[model samples]
Target: MERNAPVSRFGTVEVEDLPDDLRERLAPVVERSGFTPNIFRALGRRPAELRAFLDYHDALMTSDEGLSRAERELVVVATSGANGCPYCVVAHGAILRLRTKEPHLADLVATNPHGCELEPRQRAIVDLALRLALHPAGFGEADLRAARDAGLTDDEIWDVGSITAFFAASNRLAHLFGLRPNDEFFTMGR
Candidate 1:
């Protein structure tokens, strides 16, 4: 399942070439993940944007909110799918499978929700994330009400929106830079 190596549309930035602060911050991630994601490298084309993006990303994805890690990954996969961002769908779908131990669930959510055997609450979360990703301008009170009715706490609902918004920005950036998913993402958790 290895894809072609990503050729940086924004050109490349070797980790050693990064500023000291970013290099330090990305060290643990590269050590844990075994590679620095192309997103980090692609965004590094603009150090300020990359730093800001990663800061917000860490805040949302590593929050104390009620949304479980798997649930947060779910929002990322679902919203990335809606955005047609292949990089995020593949990368976060791998994370979703690894976290949830449900290999089929990622494809189900990405390709078609009806195909996924999600619980009602899970379905509600995915629905909200997709809506936010696809139709943010149309989102309103009723959307929040539906999420609450689905038993999501206020914090979890906030997490869902925040994750969706973050990924919406991420999706565009990935596209803008022609960032590709790491080859390892394709085989993860399978």
Candidate 2:
């Protein structure tokens, strides 16, 4: 693999080199985002995994029923930043900025969500997500109960947990692969 850009510890598979199906899948993403997120490039080495990951990610994030897009991105930002996953913080931070229309919120939440002026519901959701992401062994049923008390629906709470779990895996993958945020992510939504 020869990376067209310096986006990962491992050489990345450039879009032109990708098999037709993978190229087709990633084209719109690059068009929409104006760059390839390093995760896609790194995972593109194995097209099947990239396809599966993207499908699952879309299914989880493209929802109208549960947590709003901003909230889901919040979970990723807070956990990923705390976990030191630079790619997720920068990439999802951009998404969070777009969704919330608060350009600085992702930076604030990622660095210190507890210090951010979150609504009671956002606070509860973030707290529960943090418990699961940063300290899973200590997570408990009471955490879910607290989220319920804060007015999260069962489905929304489920979204909180599932989104956190999904990004935990993504964060780990970024660490293992030394995935770097595409430079475009730094300025997006700002």
Candidate No. with top lDDT? 1
lDDT scores for all predictions?
0.88, 0.85
| Least well predicted 10-residue stretch by lDDT in candidate 1 | 1-10
Instruction: Output candidate 1 Cα RMSD.
Output: 1.7
Clashing pairs in 2: none
For model 1, how does the per-residue alpha-carbon lDDT over 1-190 read when each residue is reduced to its tens digit?
A: 2256554676878787999999999999899889988888887878898899988998999876589889999999999888888999999999999999998999989989545789998998999998888888999999999999999989998999999989998889878777778888889999
RMSD of each: 1.7, 2.8
Looking at model 2, residue 57 earns an lDDT score of: 93
lDDT of 2 by residue, 9-41 (tens): 777898888889889988998998778788988
Clashing pairs in 1: none
